[model samples]
Target: MLRACAAAFIVAAGAGAALAQSQPPITMAINQSPWLNSFVAMVDEYEKETGNKVELDVTPFGGLLEKIRNSVRGAQGAYDIVNVNSLWLSEIYSGGFLAPLGDVQAGYGLPEGVLTYGDTTNWDAEAGTFAGGGALMGVPVNGNVQVLYYNTDIYAKLGLQPPKTWDELLANAQAIQNEGEAYGFVPRAARDSIVYNFTPYLFSHDAAFFRIAGSGKADVVVNSPEALKALETYVKLATESGPPGPGNIAQGELIQLLATGKGAQAIAVIAAWGQLEDPNASRVVGKIDAALLPAGPAGTVASSAGHWVAGIPRNVPPEKQKAALAFLDWFAAKERQVDYVRAGGVPVRGDITGADLGDDAAFRFIGAYSQNAQHAVMGLPFAQAAEASDAMALSLNRAVIGEMTPAQALNQAAADLAGVLERNGFAVTKLPDL
Candidate 1:
């Protein structure tokens, strides 16, 4: 759409084998989000260089999954590329709707230092492993991972350093809340975000929802003692330090709290770091920064990974698939990625980590992005992921609303998930109580 940005990609061309003349115009269906500016700029660069039109049919995030599924069921998919959230990989991978990028990568090859993020890339339908098994379903276009976002100015005012353990974190939050200056924390608790946002607590407590035992088997542990403790701590954080009506707090509300300088700290996705630094949209510009999530008594730190991967539809024409790969190849190169980050894109390339981003507060979150990605865990990595995650979400919403105690909520969620797994023909085991 913009021709001026083409200069950024002028010299970042791929080899001849990756390109072809007279390629048809391709459309990619993606969701509307903050990082979209970077992707749009890159595509603009591609159109200028190859003289092939690529349309980005931006859609809402809520229904993009169903739209992509519907598109791929027909003889010719509606779009050449589809944006897939890492959470939905199990369903997408199981349906075989996406073309395996690894098959074609031997030709032009992935740029050196590009990461595959196995949860988004490799998959094995038969083994129930969404993490990896040789087939590359997609390339991560967004490197979204959760991190602890804290008000740096507030911390300095209170003589607080970033906490290193859950106890220390709670003490710091309580101290900030005591000052009555701002909310000590803000939690994301909407049905869609709850499971993901709850994962760090679950994992750092050394608890889990389920663990794949073997092919088609899952051992459910969502009601374990460790899980109960994690849930109790989560409730404490939200009710004691978060905004009123924590159950209604989603991404939009949480962002509003941080951007308006009403929140002191919260664990949220690193992608939203851009909004907190936007001078036009935020009152706290240059006041917020990120740090590693505090560890639990188990001595582990965990963050949920919400990265979105881009994949070519199996039903699109061969030329379009080839063209999509070509775009991805150029898009993921280290040179282009550097420019992408400078333009507000999340860093997906391994090489982007540790590079100096200077004093720009807008790009400062890149450091946290690198740190969180290392400890990130896929919350639900199974074909029943969507169904089971929704179960967790509903229970979480109830807990924040005071409708259910943390233990009751978790137990019900565990049982509900096991039932869903069984209905889906997966053998399930409830972990023994301590």
Candidate 2:
């Protein structure tokens, strides 16, 4: 009897070990953003339902990139999943640092729209494939776009409607400046924030960093006349209509200026405006409204589409990779996407627009911005894109300080940008036809 009892105990221990092995937890690393908190909550709900554990290693957004790069290079598999900006997907996917998600999506029985491969308009086709890399690397976490946020009170006080064209924007700026008590406009012109604000102008004029060659490579086209014109126009606005020393104005100060009613208008990301609507977070509660960026010479308003993407790392085992993909599939379901939107996260799914949320004015504006984002450009390959931003910031600074002509500043920037492209292994090509 004693021998039989001991044998039964050993068998039970073996069974417990096997069960544990079958349900190992999946680990993920995410940048600290509001969306991440929602993801955590979702993960908890999923774990309760499925008995699958999730471990998250959260880090500041600034440090997350380096950590991901180093881990991928070292094959350390520190994270099974990571969130990255859509712009970096090309580099990471082409370099084989990310696992192919197509098969994983299929194996998990993910629903349509939950696993988007190409552009939303042409998902089955390869329209959004990154430079013909031939694989869908990641799933978009959020859909973001740039918009013009104005002080409605200021506009009413000055008898001005939102500008429809660049010229009109300039004229309105002048009108605001003539008031003398309030600054005309405030945009990010400093190194850290200028890129986000300046890219929209580049788009509004239909200029891009590179022109796509038929052979899936990109040729540099940053020095085009349209680009120069856009840069020159930006210089004029920063110097003539914006706050004094516009280039020296940091992002925090810019936001504060707008929130405290010191500034008339700002070109900002839609998400930033949502943050300002939060009662605990904003000083400006009912004073703001969003509109499309002014039209440029191209006769249309173009904006930059910024998206955050999530994907499984290649270093993980196939089984674990499959599990991570499963979690992502669930996280991107339309219901969950609505939850993300309610939490101030942008929605990538077409079915959930800001207008569907309710009668809130902010949500309605955000919906309009989302529609514009669908037509915006993507896939620019700026080597050290961050540094290129700094160069633009410097040119604006010079113009604001009255130290250089707009033409001179832009010309110098063109030359510097050519060097940046060449260093990144791109051939210096002719500027785009403006």
Candidate 3:
């Protein structure tokens, strides 16, 4: 039986070797995330099957863009595959750094429902295609959405219900803090992550940084009434109930605070929810549950998608490109995605929802994530997306650190984005009256 199993595995791997031969080793650049552990585990198997070397260059999230810029500008071909956040798609695609996957996708013909993991609430086919649906540019590998994580024990002890609205959320936080339970909540406030942390509130209140005009201009609207309401609400929550020195907090620190039971609740990315139930990493094992973000007064519940998409770089040699594309298809297949989920990686394949897991902590956490996907709002798409986002992040940080009032911060941010739009050749008319 053992020999038969080994023979079958080798047979299954034959296709990998058939894809290419005598090609230079392939390289992939991706951000440092917990799921990298699973990817590392699969490398040996991939090597055996493909008879080719594969190297991964994992870097901190902040350093990813600089690496891409340097490599692509130099035409160094240092990486064959590049992992990109959904937010980075527009900027990277506009630079022509990625090779369109039209031929490769047609040959592979990846089945439908396989790629439908994250929010498609605002997904546009043209954004993922070239020349208005000519070619595929990227493939989704992981999904992220915002969820409210709460300490079940604390809520039960205080006879409190999970908050369902903004007012209820704030009131619960104040009540929890008043009773000396834990820090009422924790939120990522560092400039690098603050925009994602705050956007859910902005979307919930129907506010936006800018809207794309029909003529392809960005109409700055960050200083509108709806934006002010969202900003003030986010600031008030962080100021009144969040931990001291929140301006320094990032995603890792927020997870640490929650896992150690120092925080009673948080609105955070669903990808990190597994940490609270990890026996080796958490003091709050079996005591945490997740739910959708609280709604705004207008009954809007919104979230932001943080999905990562992979694409081949234009610099790779033709033979090496074929190998890289084959590996990409194999790695993102449904079987591997299921294995990834079992290893605590975030699932992006639609078929591997929480229902596949037994009734346990993992199931409970992912259930919230699956439901929240329906409300995700992919941000505005444009070449200056990252620049505008950076400006907004700084404004959020300023408000959090008490350097500026929410209105002052937002007004300045709006002016800064307007300048960015104008410099990018997007004629900015009068600010929209939102």
Highest TM-score, which number?
1
For candidate 2, write residues 87-109 as lDDT tens digits: 56555654567776775555333
TM-score ranking, best first: 1, 2, 3
Please give each candidate's TM-score.
Answer: 0.90, 0.81, 0.81
Better model by lDDT, 2 or 3? 3
lDDT (Cα atoms) of all candidates against the true structure: 0.81, 0.65, 0.73
Candidate 1 error regions (>4 Å) = 1-25, 50-53, 107-112, 116-118, 353-358
Q: Write the per-residue lDDT of candidate 3 for residues 1-434, one digit (tens) a residue.
A: 00101111222433334553444678888888877765655544566665667788888899998887776666557778788877777677767777766644455544354443233312233333123233556666677778999999999998889888988989988888898869898878889988878888888898777776645455788788888899888888888999999899999999998999999999888877667777999999888899889888798988887778777778777766767777766666665565666666676665666556665556677667766766776555577767877877887799999999998888888888888888887777545432
Mind giving the per-residue lDDT tens digits that candidate 1 earns over 1-434?
22224334344555532463456787888888888877777777767767777788777799888889899888989989888888777788888898888655554445566665535577876776775454777777888888999998999999999998888888888999999999998999877788888999999999888888888888999999999999888999999987899999999899999999899999988878877887999998888889989899968988888888888888987778988887776678776677788766887776665455556556767677777777778777887788888877888789988999998898888888899889998888996543
